[model samples]
Target: MNKWEILNHAETACYQEEREVLVRGDRRWITALHYAFQDDNYLYLAMDYCVGGDLLTLLGKFGDHIPEEMAQFYLAEIVMAIDSVHKLGYVHRDIKPDNILLTADGHVKLGDFGSCLRLQEDGMVHSSLAVGTPDYLSPEILRALESREGYGPECDWWALGICAFEMLFGSTPFYAESLPETYGKILHFQEHFEFPPLAAAVSAEGRSLIQGLICEPQERLGAGGALDFWGHPFFSGVHWATLHHCTPPYQPTVSNGTDTSNFDVVDDCLSRMEALSGMRGSQPAGAHLAFVGYSYMATGETKDCSRDTVMSTDKQQSGDSEGLIRDNLLTESVSEELPKPFEHHLVLSKGPAGHVHGDDTDLDAAMTMELHRQLQEAEQRSRGLEEEIRQLQGELESLRARRLTELNIHEPHLFLPAHRLDATGDGKLAPPACHYPLVIRLHRHLLLFHRVWRPGVTGESYLLVCAAGVELQAWSRQQSAELS
Candidate 1:
């Protein structure tokens, strides 16, 4: 397969896996996946747009650490989120602050399940891949990679411990400059993990909870379930049953449901990730069948109710140039299949009605028209760039010609050698005598001038100029001989 096909295949596999994990419907603490679909070259997942951004952004707003009470509020919700995932027999192998999203009301929602894996019948996963943030990775996960063993959901609890420490202490407990050092610290956490003196303000109960979570996997706090942490002193006032309904310790300031002010705008374009090497070659038969049953739709929603609203709002908020560039990029991404009419098949449908309302035919038509228009604009831009490049090249050649004209006018002697061509008995011009080394110098000067002043001119043209000069000299010599 080509790079584009390889990327599409790898992304489709990931999309299918994440869709399977999230198609379970809306959970209070988990980010809800509203819908999913795939075109010829792209996969689309419409999920909840958390206005308050991720926990990492929230921590940055608070100078990298929050008060113990605020940490407890968010961590409690994260605990429930992890428990929900475990209940479904999947392990969230890559839990970190960046994956923890917050709603406008400051409630936590776990997101980004690209690394999620379902447990086998043994209630354990046997992957050798150490799939998680370096500092938050449990020692058992690293050991599993080395020993080719299995690990359970307890690794997530270990990550929760790292999150707790960072929330209170402003850093992970086992962080090091290098991956090996970080793994070493995690493996021997008894000597490496210690609360700093600067964290004196953190309560003893908070430290105890961190200790319980960052301990051995067999002794981790959430081994039983999220209910295991209900009695922890750090969560003393928390009502676990009604945590989502209760008021949070803090509320993010957002003007609208689509506001992204809480998040950092990293780039105006999507990332161009390297394609997977393993997918290079002809795809196996029925490879597309793997994503056959991956379609889903939420109940009571006739269409993507938020899509148009969000797009219009973003257009209004962003500059016209930026929006145009973004639209053109998105158009080019799927332009490979533009020659053929696009088709979408909902192989599987969820919800009580088992189908979506409204006519999708009109929607597809409208989307196709917009894509064609954007593609046209992108082509126009490309043509304009090519024209600009040609103009620059022409101007450069003119400048070189002007420089050569000035050199010829002021330093004509540079083109001549202190040598005379001799005539043979038949009156044809002969080569300059080898004793005149200046002939070589003249040839070098002529070559440099030809290349710099007229790069498009051929060496044959230079030879013709030399031949004409030689013929003139030979005619003068014949006339001198006739006079004698």
Candidate 2:
């Protein structure tokens, strides 16, 4: 596959996703233009022309590691992209350092979709021909390739873990000279780091990330899992909005035009690869037909070959009028292997069809209004419940205080019944009770209290209690009346 091929697939994938997942955003948006083929067999992707180079180059100019907070910002965006692709029934077969690109302000954009796969809706079993960068292959993928079994998106997670590890440590956890050797290490190896010794030299947040990224695919973050991982304590205080807005805390070192030009061959090869890979630039090919057509020889015969040679085109199908190339021979050909193209039955189209472009302000205002309405309703309900609770609590407290005071006036700062002297000694001389001393503070609030007394009233014995701010002030004695 070359640049032209890659761009065609990318355009197809972009259009397909536009219907289901991709949408206009608060900032940058990706739109696919028609593919242009270069004479040198390289496809020049006239994409949005993001000025920021590939993520690998950015990491190279900076240190091998990024701050955990900064990394979370990038990861959050990646997770969103992945989720969007996933919802459209696609899985990014290749997730690696080379595939992620950053814009001028450091916004990470997922660029290459050359290895995405689209699954069947029925949840039946299917096989994906292993097509991804080697180091990131999951253990299940390695097992499937080696054992000739089925594998799924779990393989992508394996790659994500390796990618995360490389970001921190500058290299993959498993590396080897040959494919088999690399797969062996990934499957059987135990990941043991120097722990606090090595990580202590790094930030605590960075250390936590390394631990998660090197784990087995089954145990690693998947889908919503990455969001939770980014929310960890290591990412505390990170300005997510600023980071998303392309305001990186630190800038990556810049490479001159000369250095970027050196990768012309790379760009060419990727374009060609994209065309031949037969996947939508962002997803798997439309159906199993292209795969089936590529799987069998024109004569409908199977061929046995080595892994490396499998990538080369054989002359057997070149002369055939049908232009069909059978690529894989291991699986048995079945009737359901080939399906009709998606557009024939789905009846759906994507992207803009007209030029009514000035509705952004209206849309924003509508969203704001809806949010405001919901907030107002929630606040009103909360206030009403709070007021009711306060009123009930106040009544209950008042009743409890009054009853307790009447039962125990001897207690400090409690109200007591009014008492008078019995002059006859027969307890029948109830005379008119007269005036009492009243204290008014400068604040114009009355301070009322009760005086204590004895049985006979001939002798003087007493106790007094005063009231203060919402509580009992103190107990004091002015004079004493002895008991009869």
Poorly placed runs, candidate 2 (over 4 Å):
1-45, 67-69, 122-125, 146-152, 191-197, 223-226, 239-243, 252-484
**Model 1 Cα lDDT, one tens digit per residue, 1-484:** 1234533546323454577778772346677777777644445678878777888888998999999889999898889889888888888888899999876556788998877888899999888887778988998999987899999999999999999999998888887789989999999998888999986799988999999999898988998787577657777766564465566787676555578798887895476544423443754555556556666787754332233324533554454332331233233222231212222211111224322211244434654776797799999999999999999999999999986665322222233222232233353442322211112221223322331232453322122123343444455455556656
Candidate 1 TM-score, true structure as reference: 0.59
lDDT of 2 by residue, 78-130 (tens): 65555445545666667887777654334566766656556556421144345
Best by TM-score: 1
What C-alpha root-mean-square deviation, in Å, does candidate 2 show against the real structure? 28.6
